[model samples]
Target: MHSWPTTTLPELPDTPARREPVRMFDPSRQAVVALTEPGQQRASMYVCGITPYDATHLGHAATYVGFDVLNRTWRDMGLEVRYASNVTDVDDPLLERANATGVDWRELAAQQTALYARDMTALEVIAPDFYVAATESIPAVVEAVEYLLVHNLAYRVPVSETVPAPLTPGAADIYADIQAIASFGEISHLDAAAMTKLFATRGGDPDRPGKRDALDPLLWRAARAGEPHWPGSGLGDGRPGWHIECAVIARGTLGDAFDLQGGGRDLVFPHHEMSTAHTSALEGRARDLAPAGARHHTHMGLVAYRGEKMSKSLGNLVLVSRLLESGYEPAAIRVALFNHRLHQDWEWFDTDMQAAAQRVAWWRTALSGYGGADPLVFLDEARLALRDNLDTPRALAAMDAWATRTLELARDGDDGVAGAAGLVSRGLTALLGIML
Candidate 1:
């Protein structure tokens, strides 16, 4: 059985020094918010994991790297963070890709998920405290759906007329009551037309038969012929929908009101909005659960390649494994990623890679044969920089300034310069998750 975190709520620290908070731009609030509460050293977070079809692209890496910094920053501040993420191991994209390649969906999901795990490890992303896959958490999903249904927040309807028949018993489309949640469209600020259009493109069948509203998202999808099935009391053989998967996994792992929720900027729309709505509705029905507020919602910026977004559809994805095979070290990739603000979208280029490689080389030479000093003093500058919304660029600049000073001192034959440089190098590696 998967071990779950204790349901006991976290307490705020009594000491003022421990209350020193880190601020971040919350997309939900549309302003900067304190991510850590005064007197609190515990954080709960959930990031939507990959579907594992086309796994671990640079864009994907960029998002995880941003959140990894969040995790690192919290820990650096002496906080105990419980982070959870869900793997959409049984989603439409996986099935479609598997069918196209004539491979079993299970085989494809396992292969790509393994690849993603390897890529995350290569990039030195901190593993989530509780990582659950969709297939693994189906029962939890069904339970949540049942909760929603009992509360009249969800209802079953006929499957999409678009999907040709031989639909199984539990195959009906279960829709969430999108209207029940206040501030439904506030997160994305998408107009009706835009929401409808985006929904159709990103996992919503706007034209599906019996949908209550144009924006009502699916909670449970009934099984179809030749698709994977999980037997359930009322959910039928069909699996959970994309949005519901995050809601259930997060609630099951992190409980009702987590400290933070993060994902790519693209998820700001139907995916995140729907997840929040589902959680909100569920919270309303369960009186014991806190009214999960508009908490700190952070999003990593989109990464582009050439003139366009690096998407699987574009066939222009720059995979992490591909870059590694081309002889670029993972440290170089980490440096390149931190070259910009985590929330800023930028294009990937050869110049970025070259500059990062140069930075890594410089650090290696500067710290060579240097007996280490207390890394705390050297890390203080980075800590300040990162406190300002994970300002990696500013932090990198600080490291650069220190490196220049160390080089000058070395040229002057100062005995203390080597130790200082070693301290700075180690601090950078620890803070940035990039090895020196």
Candidate 2:
């Protein structure tokens, strides 16, 4: 059994007094919104983890740091927050990469996971309350899938000795039914036509028996020779699909309902949408189960290089470990990333990182000579900006101003000004994990 924290959920505030704005990408509106939940004091978050096939890159760093800042800001606001990110130890990428490298899949997954943990620590990202691995949660995945089957949300397709090419049009009803839930589009952002095209490429031909729709994804993929497989109920001898692992882990760790669900913009469709659908199906069967009402918000930042997506195959990736190896300060990386708006894509470049390093150096120097000044005024302004849609650039600008003004006061030997600068530095270091 998984052990969860026994903390009580925070009570929602009465009358929804304009707490800081939350940045959200609503697929239905096709636009981003800066809003807050009514009466909710705490925020819960779940960001997808790496698939463990490649090194953790700048793209990965941007996503994690963006959320780390959000989590830090929320905690600073006195809200009890619980964050979770899962490790996808079992997947197609892991298996394929292991085979090509002639290494054991388990060893590769463990090595990459450890490297990721080291990188996250260097970036000063807070450790999630629940750091789950799919292999460890097989029982939970089975239980959730069983619940769905019992409730008629999921059905088994009989597979024969021979694997089919893809799914056929004959199984359209099952696919359509899965997509009808309220939050179906929250993940994929695709209309019916686009969805059909997208899934077709991954689907096998329907003429073969035991095949469903071409787009119908695997809730459980039957094990092949020499591949990892778990034996249990419903799924028989197979491994859980990529999407189902996340749904099962989230439901198992956070319970059926929680405050917030988050991930990169990439996961909105298919992965996130499918998870929502599965959960809704489960909820419909049991009265106690209901799709968690948390805002399925996504961040829009973390742009890739040269208009190309970051991928291991492309080999244009900048690994976080590599950056650290090159003597780049982790604090610089964190500040540069946090300086951008959460829902906007900020381009990655060498000069951008250099700028962040310079800024950190400037802040540290500015605080060396501080006299008592009202630090709260500066802290409050920055905090408010962060809460109001995660205006990181604006918040960073404010810090720059504080640094400039403090330097002016320090030069004139104003004891009060020097004191205030010290307080400001301390508060930022403590709250934002930005060390002077």
Candidate 3:
């Protein structure tokens, strides 16, 4: 598993006010729900991670930062958060990018994955309890595919491709029978036409002549020359498929009925939906596509730039490392992101960084002097705002109000206000994961 230092949580003051339970918007339910069940102290979540083909982009950072805030909020509310995530270290995109750049795929994945870890560390994201590579869980993946094939949830289909050294004639690839799942559309909620269109563009083979539905996801791909292959337990000499990777990893780490399944909004359709389906097939009963029976499907909004969503394929990436190298403070960049709601679709502007820097400067100035307003008020406001759907802008506005009050009243310099400013600053760090 990938590792990083633990972000220490701020301790409660002499009298930490009773905190409200965290409530996040669940897209599947179309309603805001408590993060954990009643009387439940421990919460489990699995978020999909990057494919590790390139540097960590701002879009990528935004997702992690948003969830980082969520992680902080949960701990503040006194819930034990067991978070797990995966790096798709052996996917098609990594191989394609490696081939295009003439670098070994393994080396490319390693270099980029290390860079991603550095960016996350610089941003101070609390690393997951289980941050594993897909390659690390192949034995578990094989067992999952074995379960699916045994229960008749997956089938084989033929492909016509040339290889330098061929062994089996009419080599067949295994596909999950989505038709067998009772809750295929519960998560995506799309009609056949929309699903088919999206499947074709989003790492799917809609045009492939298959024996089942066009939406049936690949379970095992037969070995192809010049591509990485793994033992597939008699299915063929190919690695596990995209959705199955997440299914096996998530189920293996978090177990069944985890509290939340989270990722960027783009993964709602094929990735999470099909992974959830695979989980259902493995467990041998449908939880309405709540695979491993996740209670909530929490998806962060997409980040867009220059009139299009920021994506690797588009090549309009604003990398986090590049911004740091350009002399932006990590705290300032985090404040810029905090200016927007986590679930709102917003575009990035150059001026955003400037504004965030100015905010951080003002905050530091406030912290250096004595203030009048009760520091607990700032703590209460930030926690309340963030606990509800991660309304970061509201939380930021509360901090600004506290800072403005502090600066405005510094001339009266209450020596009795010992550590008042420090309390508020630490509250900001603890509640919002912002370093003031």
Candidate 4:
């Protein structure tokens, strides 16, 4: 059986310097920041999951594996970590695809979620402690929506019989009002005027009546004919909006303000932005929330294809299952990804995969008769590099140098060579989920 991390929680560190900061990229800050905490060695994290319509792909692997490494590293350092990842089981894509495929929406969701779990296991990404489904969290979602409505952050709008025309300057005032309190531009790294232009082109209209702002996303989207709808909510018969599921799930699982939040860079805009806004707004209303005043740190990894961004809609996509089927080892794929810094995008190429495979082979050969070494020296070096804002690429380069030296020592029959190889393998395994 594959060994898993022991569930016994570690004792909290006594000093701030001893405790690792839960550092992550904050979409709000548009830069990585150390998460503010209520106590030492306690950190909470939430990452949005797939919508269940698309099959798991290289892009999905890159994201989950990246964060899984972070989670493992944090825990290995003796921190108490509670990780939550949500499944967006209900959404417009699911409904439309279900209709086109003539499959039940729930069945589709279940099958896809199961596939995702299997893929994660195959890649050795740790399963999150809380694996929630949006459909199961409907009550929590409704509660959040109700809270927003009460605070005037969200408002219900009647379906317009006639599509609204172009927004005038007066209509722009409504959008501006929501922007003032929402911090919408901050999370997206866009100025207010830039955000307005982008939103307008993406179907948001400032002139729409009953909407507090054109950019104010729907908390509860009224269900249309032939669409999936939840019945329990005080909001009329409709499914939760794409952004609301995350806020509700985070609030329910991680409380008001958790330690770290992360996902693909693509989600930095409307998705993470909305989640941050909603959660912050909710906290402003409740004085007793567990993390009522805590700050959230966010981080995102890069995207790449064959040295380019992988976009299925553009036919440049790569699937994890296909890569495996084509004889790429899971470990090699992961190592190649880790060679790139987690926060920056790098291209995916066969050469990169081959280089990772070469590293694995060299280490395995170098360590053939190796006994364990005191890994702390090498681990400390790697750890220091990682702690400097997760500089994984530089850490990997250090590993490469260490591996090269160890191989040379093995050639000379040095006793420490085997031990050094063992250290390298263990460090890579623990830090990147890459097993030689």
Winner on TM-score between 3 and 4 is 3
- When summed lDDT is taken over every stretch of 10 residues in candidate 2, the lowest stretch is 9-18
Please state the error at residue 52 of candidate 1 in Å. Answer: 0.4
Q: All predictions: root-mean-square deviation over Cα?
A: 4.5, 5.4, 1.9, 5.8
> Candidate 2 residues 78-117, lDDT tens each?
5678787799899888998999999899999988888888
Candidate 4 C-alpha lDDT tens digits along 1-436? 1212322322222323234654666666656676644356666788778888767877788888878877866776666788888898887678777888999999998888877777787788877888888888887777777776666666556664333321211211111124435344456777657666665543346456776665776666665556677663556566677676787787788876676667887776666766666666677632222222126545556577766677544557777777777788888788777777777676777577778888767656755656433345556666666666677776677666666666666567665623555556766777667667
| lDDT of the candidates, in the order given | 0.77, 0.66, 0.83, 0.66
Q: What's the C-alpha lDDT at position 20 in model 3?
A: 69
TM-score of each: 0.91, 0.85, 0.96, 0.84
lDDT of 3 by residue, 1-436 (tens): 6657767888756334335667888767778887775577888889899899999998888888998888887787678899999999998899999999999999999999899999998898989999989889888887888788888888888766655333456778889998899878777788899988989888998876865888988888787878888877677677778999998888889996788888898888888889888878788875353444677888788888888999999998889999999999899989998898867778888789999998899889888764446788888888778778889999999999988777767756644356788788788788777776
lDDT of 2: 0.66
Worst 10 residues of 1 by lDDT: 3-12
lDDT of 3 at 108: 98
> Which residues of candidate 4, in runs, are more than 4 Å off?
1-24, 30-32, 36-39, 161-184, 197-210, 285-294, 306-308, 371-374, 417-421
Candidates 1 and 2 compared by lDDT, better number: 1
The prediction achieving the highest lDDT against the true structure is 3
